[model samples]
Target: MSSFLTNSLKLLSGAIVAVALVTSAPALAAGGHGRKPVDPGFSFEGPFGTFDQGALQRGYKVYREVCSACHSMKLVSFRNLGQKGGPFYDPKYKNPNDNPVVKQIASEFETAEIDPDSGDEVMRKSTPSDRFPSPFKNDEAAKASNGGAIPPDLSVINKARNGHAPYIYSILIGYEPKPVGLEIPDTQHYNAYVAGSLATQWKGDPHHVPAGGVLAMPPPLTDGRVTFDDGTPSTLKQQAKDVTTFLEWAGDPHMVARKQTGFAVILFLILLGGVVYLAYRQTWKGHH
Candidate 1:
């Protein structure tokens, strides 16, 4: 019995170590122990808060010009952008597929499909219903292009990490020069917002550890890299906020609808409870 107990403990220890190694990489990449992200205090905050269409449009532009190069949003489609509550939503176009803007955006992308007449696979202009295309052909190609790091899909990236938008926002603008004493690899960038322990990489004072983490992805955004059509200044902060907003919308296209429904349900439940109470009192008014 004692021998079995010892073996069980050993197995548990081994499992714990394995799990740590497996999850450590993702944790490090994401902003785990890094500096807290700044709250942008977006317009879409409270239960009744609605998405800002202008910001969404600008963010989409930023994504199209910059992020779309490395990350892919496989879950979202052009039609989603014209949905009732989406960035380019137009009430005139009830069906997002019928939206002219959506059709134009979709046509810009080329996807592989089998031609009905020839039955041969060919690249064709994408339709509103098609999902966003990935930059790399496959995982191996993606890794080869990105220095062996497979960029995470951005479809649900906003929901993947805590403090979603703020976390993403901080990381984008968090690039900074390394401290005078500390040394980092040329390939890696020092972003204070990323989550990683740098004991192995830190050569600074033992008592004063570094404040940020390092990541393979360099500063993805630069001021004036993208020009907003709405005339919003292309500052780093604006770009970060706009892109974060777009990501939030991408991650939860039904967020506004979901919140509105929840509020209505709560109000309906309250009214129902009141009615039940009044009915019970009226039914027993002559008695107790």
Candidate 2:
């Protein structure tokens, strides 16, 4: 009985160690500890807030000129650009496609289509109804082109992280020169914000602690990389803020409407509570 108990204890210990190793793999890869993002104080943060249309529009421009080259936004459609609360929303043009801005934006891209007569694939001018086309035809192609790294879709990126707006904003502007004495693997960029995904480097190196390692994506943003039409300064900081705000808007297009509805509901509940209290007091005035 004593022998059996000893064997069981050993097995349990082994199982616990295995679970811990599996769970800690990701943390180990991302250098185990890192700084958290500070809030950028966006206009759409509070309960009564709304998205800045100008910021969203500029953000869209930044995405189109920079991020669109690598990342795919498959979930977003061209028509969404002109919808209510969107950057290109125009009260004068009820139909999104009819809006000149949407039309011009759509016309800039060439979408893949099949030719009816030859049954061959052909490129044609895109429309407001079409989605933003992928820079790569497929994942394998994207990886092949970009050193085996697949860029994530940005359509719902803001919702994916814990501190959506701030986290992404931090990552955008976080790339820095690697610290002295820190050995980063080749092709890996130093980013204080990006928690890397793989842990193969940590294997067999119990003493070689992680100090923030490789990211497949090289630092993409640089100062003066894009020209803003709104005359916003073309600095890296400004670009990052604009793009991050745009992503926030994309992820929560109905945030303003939702907040408004919530306020109305709370007001109604308060009025109803007051009326109920008055009726109860009047009815029980003599009974009490």
Across 130-195, the per-residue lDDT of candidate 2 in tens digits comes to: 999999999999999888889888988999976588878888888878655455577877677665
Candidate 1 residue lDDT tens string, 1-288: 999999999999999999999999988765456887888888678887878999999999999999999998999998999998898999999999999999999999999999899999999899999999999989999999988999999999989987688889999999999876778779889988776676677887977777778888889899999999988899998998999999999999898999999999999999999999999999999898
Local distance difference test, each candidate: 0.89, 0.83
TM-score of 2: 0.81
* lDDT measured at residue 94 in model 2 versus the true structure, 0 to 100: 90
Q: Going through the candidates in order, what is the number of backbone clashes in each? A: 0, 0
Weakest lDDT window of 10 consecutive positions for candidate 1: 28-37
**lDDT at position 186, candidate 1:** 90
The collision pairs in model 2 are none
Q: Where in model 1 is the C-alpha error above 4 Å?
A: 1-32, 116-120, 279-288
Winning model by TM-score: 1
